[model samples]
Target: MLTELHIRHFAIVKSLDIEFRNGMTAITGETGAGKSIALDALSLCLGSRADASLVRPGCDKAEITACFAVAKDSPAARWLAEQDLDAEDECVLRRIINKDGRSKAWINGSPVPLAQQKSLAPLLVNIHGQHEHQLLTRDEHQLHLLDQFARHNHLLEATKAHYRQWADTEKQYRQQQQAKADREAQRQLLEYQVGELDEFALAEGEFEQLEADHKRLSNHRSLDEASLFALNALYEGEHNNANGLVQSAGQRLQESVDMDPQLGSINELLKQAMVHIEEAALELRHYQDQMHIDSAELETIEQRMTQALKLAKKHQCSAAELYPLHQQLKSELQTLIATDEASEQLAEQRQTLRQAYREQAKKLFDSRQRAANQLSDKITSAMQQLNMPHGRFEISVDHDNQAPATAKGTDQVQFLVSANPGQPLQPISKVASGGELSRISLAIQVMSATQQTVPTMMFDEVDVGVSGPTAAVVGSMLRELGGQCQIICVTHLPQVAAKAHQQLQVAKHTDGKETQTDVRALNNDERVVELARLLGGDKVTDLTKANAKELLAS
Candidate 1:
């Protein structure tokens, strides 16, 4: 339950500190007395959005803090543990909004994201404002309420899991089917690519070697003629040869050796030179005899090289990459063919999952039917006690065939009310008056007592459109609910105010220059005065005071 609330520079509230306690507490004041302001501040602390306009005129920022004390084994204790925040027995939630639309939130005095703060709220407090009753018309909330009443969360979770699997399988199946039309076209393209590349059959390093061989073959005659001429001039000449000339020189030098001793060294050098010339003449004869040219082989090499270059250009790759490209294309085409087969297999699995989801959804439908029957009875009884004697409540669970399998279920639930006898039961949103709706909402709340998750509930003017005996019953319902958990109600009805275990009266005053709102816990005498004021407007007559005293005594 909420322990304390503090508001600073929030709206017209400069600074306010209020301590709350167990049981039902009534907050009452005249029009424009800031009764809604207190609820607004509490809502902010409970993770509602904050705006710059909420700040006081002269203040730079607005702050609201709510403190809660929970049991050791409560959901909040586990939440704090999960978040790694400091937790003892109490949790403090604080929110601050600056004048520039910037805001901050804290959990247990540790800085936290706004989403974390919002996540923590449902476990601590449940606030039902005037507009919240409109949720009765929504399919999701109606199904949610049915599930809560049924206490079948485990089964609901199973249904959701099965539905998700079915949904995902269906999605993949659709995508693959959409691609099937293009699959054949793509496969043919890849096959053609593979065939084109295969014609090259070029080996690594073969392109360079072939180019070199072709060049040599093309210049074969020129190379042979040049070598033969050079050899004839040096050694194969018919008139004179290099070997004979060198031998003649050596003989002449030997003859001159008799005249000079230095001529003997020159004769030996000429003899060695004649031996090298004779070796060169033998090699030139072998070279001239071995030369042979083939034009056919050269033409074949040129054709092969041209084909390799053309294939490389068409594939946007080098001549050496054609073989690898062929292998890659073959692998991709094979996979595409396999995908068509795999897609059929997945379609069969999707059907299986859909069947599973249908079985799970049927179970949910049966559970909701049973729960809705029991809830309708309980709420109808509650409405009778709330002064709607002729009112009838009904829950319609209609099957929705066209709804998605992954949605809440195959059922569309709606709440209907007939406020008077002979009036056909119509949708709650269309037929129930504001006062009747308030009572119906109260009835539903009372019926789902065990399903309430939080230990604290605040009803902001739940008695707004109710008065007379209905207002008294509304107060009784709130007091009865207080026995199980804390209840805070802001109201303008004396019947409701007089039933509270504690009453806080909000009043505003101006000191000629500044206006301020204050909330003070009313004593027994003060309660009478406040109740009398509520009953008689600004004039608390003796009869109204007596009536107020009688209500307090009861």
Candidate 2:
């Protein structure tokens, strides 16, 4: 239940703090006196959209805080625990709206996204606005109300889940059917391309080796000439050959070694140089013997390289990538082959899901039928109390087996009513007058409230088109509802205001420079005065006061 509300700089409310108790509370004020200011503030804390105009004229920001007493096992408590924002059995929701229309929300002093507050709002408070009855004309709203009345959340969720799964599988099946021919064509093309690549069978690193051999063979003549010239110059040449010259220099250095020890080291270096030259000459002679000019081998390598380049270009890759591309195509072909088998499997799965969806939807349809009958009886009874003694109310739950499945199932729910005696039942939207609609809307709301698990319900002038004894009945109904949960109503009717266990009077005060709206809890005497004012308008007569007292005594 809501415990307290603290609002500052919101609308004409400069600052207000109000404590709430565990029964019906009526908020009353003159026209334009901002009777709904507290409701508006609470809405902001409950994650309603914010506007800069809601801030007081000269204030930088508007702030609203709402505190609730949460049962340990209530939905709000569980949600708070899940969000790691639990504060024992108390939950505080705060909202701050700046003049620029930017807003921030907090739960238990921890900042949170506005969406988080929105998600938690329904679990804490259920607000019925003045214009909520206008939505009753909509078919979707009617269906939603029926479902809420039914309270078969688990069955509805299961139906929705099955519908989604079936719909998804159906979509896949249709897409696969449409793409079957294209898939077959692709498979044939892949088979041909993969076959060609397999026949070529290029090994890894073979291209580079082939290129090296091709270069070597193409330059074999020049290589042979160079090696023969080097061999003769180093070892085979008899006149002034490198080996003969180095040997003569080493012998001269050895003869002078006895005269100078440094000359001995120079002679050893000359001997090492001569040995290196002789070994190099022998290597050159071996290379010259191994070198050959083979035109046929060169042509064969060239042809192979040409084919590799052609294949690489066709596949949009380099010659070295042909082997990898071939393996990738093979994998794709295998997957496409497996997809054919998967299509059959998916067909079977779709049939199974379709059957499952039908079963769940049927269960939901049956539940709606049962709930519709009970709700119709209750609303009809409530209508008689609201001054429509001859009114007949009924709920039509029609299930179409041939209709395509939807997340909400195949049930069409409509509210039918006959507001006058001898009138045939018709759709409420087409038959009920504005006043009748308001009362019917109120009856539905009352019924919905009883089924709600939330601890607090706020009605914002839902008694708009009701007056006389009907207004008193509405008030009494709200008071009775308060016995089960907290009820806060913003109303103008004195009958309604007098029925509340507590009354709050809203008054607008203005100076030359500023206007402010104030809300104060009304004591018994003050409540009498307020009720008298409501009864007699701006002038509170002695007769009106007496009547106010009489209304209160009832």
Candidate 3:
């Protein structure tokens, strides 16, 4: 419930402060007399777009503040808490617009974004006007409003979860199908590469061994000639042969060894050298015989080494890495082979999720239909006293099973109306006049408010195009609804304005060169004059005041 509103330098309202109360409190003023300014101020706090042009000509900025008495668990309070804003049992919202077209909004003294303001607005007040009736025409908004009125929040949450599940499942199914399609192209590439690698059949360390063999074979003739020459010089050469020379020296050293013991040790050393020289010559002969060069084998080994190096460079890796690369390709091939294996499983899972989505959607549709019938009947009963004797209102539920399911549901619901006798009921947007729409909107609001948990309801211009008994009925209905929650109605009807438990009059006054609008809570005597002014005009005649008093007395 809005407890108070303060406006400064906003439009024609230089400054205004008004305290509001529970039950219907009407605001009455002449046309262009700043009644809409009060509503505009409220709209600013409720997140409506701000225009710098609304500022008083000489003012630098326009500001509006609205205070609401909120419940601890009220949606508005909850929203404020979620946004990390200050919220207590009472909430104060302030909006300021500067002359440069910049605007700032605050909740409970904490600055907040405009989006947060909009998200929190509905929790503070619900305004039903000529435009708000669009809620009845739009399918999703209608469902949401109806569910709110029915207090089926938990059910709506469940439906939303199911909708999300359906969407997620479809997304996964599409991805899996695309993966299957992509696998075929990948398989062709993997198969060709794997075939090439398998055919090579290269051995580990084989490249190193081949390189060694190629070097040895390339110098085989030179190695053979050097070994043969060394062998002849060591064992078979004339006087310079190492074996013959060392033996001859050992014989001389032994003959001399008898002359001295040191000569005998030197002879032993000479004999050892002769033995080692003979062993070396024998090994050289063996190598000379084994050094047979085969050009064909050398060519084959050289070609193998060249091919390995070329493949390594082409793949930008060493020859040793080719084996691991082969294994990777084989693994990918297996994955491609198994792509169709899981296809059936995906289809089955999709069917199951589809069935679950349908079941949840069906349950939501059934609950809405049941609740819509009750709501339609309740609102029709309330519309009777507003002067449409044979007035009929209905909720037409159209199932869109063939249409794709949306987040709300697979059903479309609209409010239908017939304003006069024998007139076929049509969509509320199509058949209702401004007066009829006002009353219908009020009736629906009354019904919806009764079922809501909100602590306040604010009505702006709800009494437009209504007067006399119709306005009285509207006022009485608002009062009745106010018994359930805080109700505030902005009106110009003297009949309705007179019915307020509290009366606030919006008066514009020009003091010297300054123009200002201020809202005042009228005392009983003042209310008489205000209502008389509403009934008559700028001039409140004595007869008008008498009639106003009489109306109050009744």
lDDT: which is higher, 1 or 3? Answer: 1
Please give the lDDT score for candidate 3.
0.80
After TM-score superposition, the amount by which residue 59's alpha carbon in candidate 1 deviates from its true location, in angstroms, is 2.9
For 6-90, candidate 3 gives per-residue lDDT tens digits of 8888888877888888877777776767776777788888899988798888889999999988877778777777877756788
Backbone collisions counted per model:
0, 0, 0
- Deviation (Å) of 67 in candidate 1: 0.7
By TM-score: ranked, best first: 3, 1, 2
lDDT score at residue 431, model 3, on the 0-100 scale: 60
Clashing pairs in 3: none
Who wins the lDDT comparison? 2
The residue-by-residue lDDT of candidate 2 on 167-283, one tens digit each, is 999999999999999999999999999999988888888788889999999888888888888888888987988898899888888889999998987898898998899899989
User: In order, what is each prediction's RMSD in angstroms?
Assistant: 5.4, 4.9, 5.6
Error of 3 at 187 (Å): 1.7
Which is the leading candidate under TM-score? Answer: 3
Worst lDDT 10-window in candidate 1: 399-408
1 or 2, greater by lDDT = 2
State the RMSD for candidate 1. Answer: 5.4
> Could you give me the TM-score of model 3 versus the true structure?
0.80
Q: Give the distance in Å from residue 174's predicted Cα in candidate 3 to where it truly belongs.
A: 3.2
